[model samples]
Target: MPQPVLSLDALRALDAIARKGSFAAAAEALYKVPSALSYTIAKLEQDLGVQLFDRSRQRAQLTSAGLLLLEQGRELLQASQRLEEQVRQLDSGWEQRLRIVVDTIMPWAPLWQLSADFTALERFTRLQFSEQVMAGTWEALLRDRCDMALGLAGEGVNAQVELHLLGYAEFAFAVPPTHPLAQRVATTPDEPVRREELLAFTAVVVADSAAEMPGRDSGLFAAGHVLQVPTMQAKIAAQLAGIGVGFLPVHLIQQELLTQQLVVLTTEIPRAPVPLYLGWRKDVVTGQACRWWREHLLNLPWQQLLTPGELKAHV
Candidate 1:
């Protein structure tokens, strides 16, 4: 019996044809003549003893076998690229890629600014951003799927992971400008309702465990109607729809506040802001880009995010 030989070039040609949807398009992308591409596919079909594509239409459509082969081809190609990247990093003496996993609830402006600055240095650095729930983001770092994570500290984060306190993000109850809460006086209203009073009405909260405001454990949330939502955007939408009062980051709702779409609750509820931290594996030495970002985040003037009293408490 004779063993069959594998044809990598033919496989590449088939992969390109499947991706581009036509021999002409694949040829153009691969910088090969259409005849050459067709020949490669023909050879591939012969070697596999199966029809890879249906030729009835002007465009190429993958047969069942072709679809399976294309899926496997993509996985193989990705693995090959990862191997090549690792080898290239070894040769260069430093890995230039920075993989970051962050909580979806964090403010976007600072993060975007940091990313722009890092890439502007032109240091061969690549940035990968993974937006996940709080616990999910920490899991990514612990599993070695990401280099760092930004979110609240969580249980089960590995001992090897170092936590850097970035600052605190205060949580506030926001309502529409015409809501009754806005009509109340700012200085502790007479007969002030407890924090849980808002929950007597509909309370829209970030459904994800990671994005939830801290201090929820306080008795204020014990007996109230609660609606769980997945993202900040969804929570805002629900609030705008008058579904319920929502706990949201002040920065996220600044535009809404300015537009009079939302107003802060003046009830005597305890205000507990969440502490933000940047976590990374302590054993792993950070790259130049990651280190630069860590320093920048640490030095940010948090006073912008805190009120005078809150700033005094933090200091």
Candidate 2:
């Protein structure tokens, strides 16, 4: 009699073993006991008539046959995931579950309102927000882990992805109220301040993946005199302490600007406004819930959200 084919559950068990390097780890990841996982793997090997793992060592290692099986297993898993994604997308309209990723810098109030509008349309609608940096958002969209993403336009934005420009936000050179720029009138397009004027001041910049600084090569800001801080909130605190002048999102500083805690630099250099894009995979079909949220964002009057001066301060 011929051996039976391996089951999807068996393939999953083997793949998990390969990924986790031990039966115990795989079992934990799969929410199964080690013995159960071992039994599944043993059954799989029996069906294939070949040993999938070298059981001699403390950690499970893939045999040559195991390696070959692993490659095929991964392909099968990916196909299964894709199929499930398609089915989920088709049926998601009635389910009310919407997964979305947004840039960390995106305003929270507007997003809350967007969610409220979506839920009002369908009370069962649910929103999941994944906070990621510029590049990570695109990755989430491509992986089908998220239905939509909002982020700044960047080079890695795939051509296969669809991007909608929500609006442009100006970048402003901000400093404490006591800073020299605080005393001067805001800079205009024709009279933009020279880079040399900024060099004399210290610049506190956000560091690491959390930071949303503009592309360095874009000539949007001077790169040499930067003091790298970790988070946007920390950068703001540094500015308040009068440590340095850093480029900040205009909307984020609205309260500071009004209370005289922060002041915008006056320069002829045009405010470098970064265009924000709402991105989604071009090939993925969105459900009604996703469509409703997208249209809600498109219809938002962003102009009314911030003052004209605040908008120009950053761009």
Candidate 3:
């Protein structure tokens, strides 16, 4: 007998079933009836003369042979997608998708508005957003995981990377109005708090998003306790609740400062204004969608992108 020839549809059925975990779910995703999907998988298994999924499990799970095939099949599918995308790009210069990695410190409202405007252009490019903190922003761009990076902290000096200065943002050591630090600052307005006093309280810091890479500490005591949260918003909330005190981007908490909800603490070591940059890989040719986004961001004033507050006056 001749060797079995696999069809793309059959491979897709296997993938969908594996991805969705059940034939019923996969059928819904593929816009097919459950029975049809089941028949397709059965036919594929019969043709290959091997069991793709173990019948005992409630969820569609791949056997060792199935796992091997699925791994290679995904690569083949991805290559096919790339080929199609390239052809489409040749015909119309718009990219199929654009991935942007942004630092969580940046305000989201303006970015969302910009994305809405981009969508209005009808360029048919999908926008993917990933939030990264500190070094993770740089790492995402270097690893080719993102097409563009916004609000990056430091200079990435490499021939393959292109960097542009966004602006500088000042960070303040803010504490809740009811906190001891705030009360002390209110009473002793002229004196700076000692490091030991500051260390006595827990520091609220945003946990770095980097995987496998070493994370950086922005404004936490070296020997003190910390309450690590996933996002910058959570950090601010923790600080507002008097859970912990740490450095926060001034623009992010301007409203709270104006309302005296959060008070700034004068510390022995005042953090210098951090400079942010926009970075993209120089190696990859900037696609139409990416170029459009870059131009749009470059034209936007940094002050307008941040949360509206009297940060400059406070700093």
Taking all chains together, each candidate's TM-score versus the true structure is 0.59, 0.56, 0.69
Q: How accurate locally is residue 188 in candidate 3, as Cα lDDT from 0 to 100?
A: 81
lDDT of 2 by residue, 1-315 (tens): 975586778889888888887889989999999999999988888877899888898766889999998999889988888667656655655444689887655676788866776667634556788776555556677778788887644543468788877677666677775666554434333444567777777667654342333323222356347677645667778889987776777777788878877766656565566777887888987777777777887787654543336333322
For residues 1-315, write the lDDT of model 1, one tens digit per residue. 867644657667877887787789889989999999888888778877998889898766899998898888777777777777766764665456789887766766778877887768655567888776656666677678788887644443457788877666666667776555555434444545466566567777664443333323211243367777766677788888787775666666777777777766644664666666788898877666677777887777644643223211000
Better of 1 and 2 by lDDT: 2
Candidate 3 residue-wise lDDT, 196-309, digit = tens? 887688988788888756887656665368888888999999889888888899888877988988877777878887778888988898778999999988888885445345
Show where candidate 3 strays beyond 4 Å: 1-90, 303-315
**Backbone clashes in model 3, listed as residue pairs:** none
Among the numbered candidates, top TM-score falls to 3
Q: Which stretches of candidate 2 lie over 4 Å from their true place?
A: 1-92, 121-125, 154-157, 180-194, 208-225, 229-231, 268-270, 303-307, 310-315
Q: Is candidate 1 or candidate 3 better by lDDT?
A: 3
Q: How much does candidate 1 score in TM-score?
A: 0.59
